[model samples]
Target: MKAFNDFADRVRKEKREHYSKPVSYCLNYILVYIYEPITLNQLANMVNLHPNYLSTLFKKEIGVSFSEYVQKAKKLMKRNNS
Candidate 1:
């Protein structure tokens, strides 16, 4: 169990680094939007940020709003399903 826990911790750390490296709020938002299925307000709460501020940051970094990002992700999911 200890070894399994260690392995899980390592995997989590690597995943966090993979997401944090590029540090694009939009990408993070998109990923969370697709995989997590939470509201914008909930996501903002998770990150301890204001929803409007997060929205602006996402736009600045990704050149699109969170809604657009989620739409693109959903489209990709649909394409993959076929």
Candidate 2:
């Protein structure tokens, strides 16, 4: 059981690292196009992902919901006058 648990942990870590690129791309896109309207479905299409899969992967990799992350980024941009 202990060995199985360790393997599971390792797999989850690897999955997170593997998913980082798509998450990073989404983050950068949101920042660069912060002023433009965007939706999860639209982002999913842009990233060649299914909306549900992207939503789960994004929350797992980013530690927040997509909308929450976008809102926080927009707030920071506004404060910085960007």
Best by TM-score: 2
C-alpha RMSD between model 1 and the true structure: 9.1
lDDT of 1 by residue, 1-82 (tens): 9999999999988765453222255466556557567566776776777898877766665567877878888889779888
Task: List the candidate 1 regions with Cα displacement exceeding 4 Å.
Answer: 1-36
Best by lDDT: 2
Query: Candidate 2: which stretches are off by over 4 Å?
Result: 1-19
Clashing pairs in 1: none
